[model samples]
Target: MPKLTFAADLQWRRRFARAAEGLALRFALEDARDLRDEPDGADDPDHVPLPVHRDDYDFDACTDMFFQDTDVLMLYNARFDGIEDPGGETNQQIGMGDLCTAAWFDPFGNVKTRDPHRGFRR
Candidate 1:
């Protein structure tokens, strides 16, 4: 498991948290977007604890904070364009282009990145 990073959009966090909670997994969440957007003492009255706010921290901090015991699931786009269904070759249609989804990552560096602060590129 290599240390890989996946950037998940903020909207999906709640649903993910609920699902993980139900599955008896202790998941942690940091708002990366927030971290990116807000830098140098930018605090909202209703500031949520997100990655944007905590840019100083790295990947390990996120993993330790959220994915301590459970697997880390990051959301990403499933760009399966132009891939036709095998059984339905006659029907020509592109696959679902983009959507909020999750991917499981191992705890070790092999699964995810050891450097939490690194920007995710996908």
Candidate 2:
């Protein structure tokens, strides 16, 4: 895996620094040995899905627990593969939520904001 640098700009950097001070990040790696095992939320009893790997580890729990500190801000970065649209070949979106983690803001931070779906206060 490549090194993913995490930082913020002048304004948000101060906010992030103030919020993340003295916080400890707990990292856990999920282990999977079987490649043909039943999935966790399989609705169909007859269908066995491919086994999950370390990459499938869900961070919701960690986020929920840590995000309770309402005074702090949690930033997460997500990347997806394949981009095919009349707009271009890349689709990058940033999501910012309130204390409830309900996306109060989600915009294309990396791309031009000429799109109709682009806005800062959605």
Candidate 3:
């Protein structure tokens, strides 16, 4: 596994500091196993499909739905055993709810606002 160099760490810190302005920070843990095994709400009546562009939809649409109002900073624990394959592919999975929940709760206590003219208020 590779480690973040001092310069890289400093650069990330500077970028994070800048982005943190008027925003809250949150930390959540989701094991790759759990994500991989999560049910797709096939039998759940309350399940609502994520929004996507009507014409062309794909993984990017799912990502857009997930990070609608919030920015994501992913930190992978590649040093952990059994998480990566020889091809360097990871078993991690990210879904729309994760981003929505992060934005819903201002974990760092930053105020949230939404445009009144818009239908939804966050």
Best candidate according to lDDT = 1
lDDT against the true structure, each candidate: 0.37, 0.33, 0.35
Provide TM-scores for the models: 0.23, 0.22, 0.22
Segments in model 3 whose C-alpha atoms lie over 4 Å from true places: 1-7, 21-87, 91-122
Stretches of candidate 2 exceeding 4 Å from the true structure: 1-8, 21-23, 27-64, 67-78, 81-122
Summarize candidate 1's per-residue lDDT along 26-97 as a digit string, tens digits.
222335434536664347545446456445546456555644332112212133321223233322332322
Structure candidate 3, residue pairs in collision: none
Error of 3 at 19 (Å): 1.1
Candidate 1 lDDT = 0.37
Best by TM-score: 1
Model 2 agreement with the true structure over 3-121: per-residue lDDT tens digits: 12232245444433443422435322112212223365344444346575674435555456544432222223233312212133332232222322222223335634335433233
Model 2 error, position 34 (Å)? 22
On the 0 to 100 scale, the lDDT of residue 118 in model 3 is 43
What TM-score quantifies how close candidate 3 is to the native fold? 0.22
